[model samples]
Target: MGNSKKVILLGNFGVGKTSLVRQYVFRKFSDDYMTTIGVRIDKKMVAVNGQEVSMIIWDVAGESTHQKIPNSYKLGAHGIIYVIDVLRPSTYLSIEKEISSLEDLLPNVPIVKVANKIDLLTEKERIEIVNNLPLNDYVLCSAKNGSNVEDAFNKLAESLI
Candidate 1:
């Protein structure tokens, strides 16, 4: 492995942060909705572009724009996986504010805007929703179907290196 890097999954409530992490770390998914209390940590080893890397994933409890994000959770994070459920408009709203918060708290860390739960949307709908996001590039994924789950993690690992 090259190096261990701390990466976090952050987004609004019910956006599938735990699902994404579970699918990536364990290759499993459940339909249950168990809200994360503070933060759940998981680690996965991945080989990215011939470099092995350990991705330390911090799955923080989801919160809305009205709620305050914990800066303490952002410390030591090398990358951010800002996940969004594509079927919900409210999850994607306040994206700029969230990004701004992350940037302010954890500057210089690369972020992968992940559009999760694509399984709930048709291909056209997914494309349209992704195209309309405030991000320049993002990974469209489905934790339930295990779609692009590794890719999202790999993208983050690549950024860390």
Candidate 2:
């Protein structure tokens, strides 16, 4: 398929938005940490149900403390994936508020709730964190280890269709 769909990755700083994209698109991960400026866009072609789908992923900068999100980055989005590092409780704490803001900005676009860095957490720890966060379409993934990375993309792509 030649069609392109805009998908966005939303989360706090260093929640692995870029890392997830790297894992999915390039199948690579790094130990270094780099903060995204305004936005970094990536593209990946994936097959869902035997049909090729192009996902244009927008990795937006982490929302500043007590600041509103940029409207321009959210426009024309087909799907949104909110990533949270399981080790960081603070990341998932304000998810309810974030989701509300996103829903208001892009009303009907499907959002996928993702808990990344699962490889760092114990099974019990993962459950404890996920239980606290709101779950619409939730997935647990480890970008460093390539666990459920494809599933996260497929879940969003499936919703796009």
Candidate 3:
């Protein structure tokens, strides 16, 4: 394994990508809607499966028109956490398109499908969405409550390592 792993947080605007990162790393939450102007970087040392791992988490800007993330960002990423809002069906629908684009840019890199805001969905609705996906790798998470957030990161780390 590399000395450090690069992971990118990807999703559409207003889908809680930043909120998920903030909650995971800082354990805080807010209801504000601020567009991420550029890539925000955070680092943490994690112990995954008994080995120490350093994570260089790139919280990529959500704005589609913002060109802050250069093409090079996709080159070195070991894994990607593709987040989609469970409360917003359109965001869920767009996951495939986003994944396609990512694969085109970085084929063969592992991707962890994250259904964020799971706390807002009922069991039936959650099941419906899960049943319809490609089902390679996925996690149901709630950044607001810290549910399954660590598991999502751990799963990605496990794959990368």
Best by lDDT: 1
Candidate 2: stretches off by over 4 Å? 64-67, 134-136
Candidate 2 local lDDT, residue 130 = 70
**Over the full model, what C-alpha lDDT does candidate 3 score relative to the true structure?**
0.79
Query: Worst ten-residue run, lDDT, model 1?
Result: 65-74
Give per-residue CA lDDT, model 1, range 1-161, as digits (tens): 34888888889989999999999889999999999998899998888788778888889999885136667777888999998888888998888887887788778999999988999988788778878877768888899999899888888888888
Descending-TM-score candidate ranking: 1, 2, 3
Q: Per-residue error at 106 for model 2, in Å?
A: 0.8
Tens digit of lDDT per residue, candidate 2, span 24-128?
Answer: 999999989998888898999878788888999898887632135667778889999988888887888778887887888789999998999989888887778
- TM-score of model 3 (CA atoms): 0.85
Each model's lDDT = 0.86, 0.85, 0.79
Model 3: worst 10 consecutive residues (lDDT sum) = 62-71
TM-score of each: 0.91, 0.90, 0.85
Estimate, for each residue in 1-161, the C-alpha lDDT of model 3 and write its tens digit. Answer: 56589999887678788888888788888878788776889976788778888888998876442233577766789889888776766666656666778888888898988888877878998788677755456788998888999889888888877
Clashes of 2: 0
